[model samples]
Target: MKANGPFKILALLFVTVLAFYLIAYHTIEGRRNRNGPWIVAFTNDLSGAPALRIDHPALAITNVQLVFPDAMLPTNFTAKTILFQRPRPVPFPLPMGECIFMDTTFLPGSVVMRMSGHEVQLIPRVLTINGREQPWKSGETIALTAILTNAISPRLNGR
Candidate 1:
């Protein structure tokens, strides 16, 4: 009877923790998918500075400047692309900036780009540019594009 009591308590604790985790995960996923998937692209502007462009089936946003802390910029001048499937984590209860777009909850994740004959992959928390991997900084601002048609690929200016 004593052994069963400890086992039951441990089982109950595990179940409670799992339930809380699942609830949180579902809530986040719900918020993320509310706006559907967005495609994000990063490329150099006319002045050779990095610029962000977003494309959605229902919205058109472009020429957004990506502000980085301490002037940190991507070393490669080529274009990078990512599919945003999750909501960007916010530190405040309410967003601080103006709501330019309807959904501002997406983040760039699992990206791939080509630069100078090298394959670059930008996964969450990891950045691989020119075949070299580095830690993706949190201070860097992210941007994304959107997919509208099944035949067209998600890219800026068709590559």
Candidate 2:
């Protein structure tokens, strides 16, 4: 039996086209997950310090991972000195600030003294913006006063 030359050429062409198509498809669809950091300004103040209450019509932060500076007081110490209070767990997106309060007792956990123990507080506290995987932006400086009001986490309690 004799083979055909045109058939071989056609076969090679088909392979070449298939390779190119695969490469282009992978490039377009294989983009990995990418997300940017979160940065926001404290538009108002509560009591005396600038804080975000999260009380307006119930604003909820989902998957909030607070990234404080390494120099900030340890989590255990803060729990011991600071008194953390939160609103009754009613539902998602509860009130922001007014419902929660940090009593000045310093009864057992005093995050204030432990935090103030250090001479200086680091600027531009990095927090997850919109549950994204990027750190917040400072832009030359901490653009606004960001009081880490509600850090909803199960691992570390107290504030």
Evaluate all candidate structures by whole-model CA lDDT and list the values in order.
Answer: 0.46, 0.28
How many steric overlaps are in each model, in order? Answer: 5, 14
**Tens-digit per-residue lDDT, 1-159, candidate 2:** 247788888999999999999998776544321111112222222222322211111112222212222223223331211112222332222112121212212211111111111111111232322222244332222113234445568657753
User: Which regions of candidate 1 fall more than 4 Å away from where they truly are?
Assistant: 40-54, 58-159
Over the stretch 42-112, how does candidate 1's per-residue lDDT look in tens digits? 55555554454444442333322342222223454457664456444432111111111222344433434
Model 2 whole-model lDDT (C-alpha atoms): 0.28
TM-scores of all predicted structures = 0.32, 0.22
Return the lDDT, model 2, position 132: 29
Best by TM-score: 1
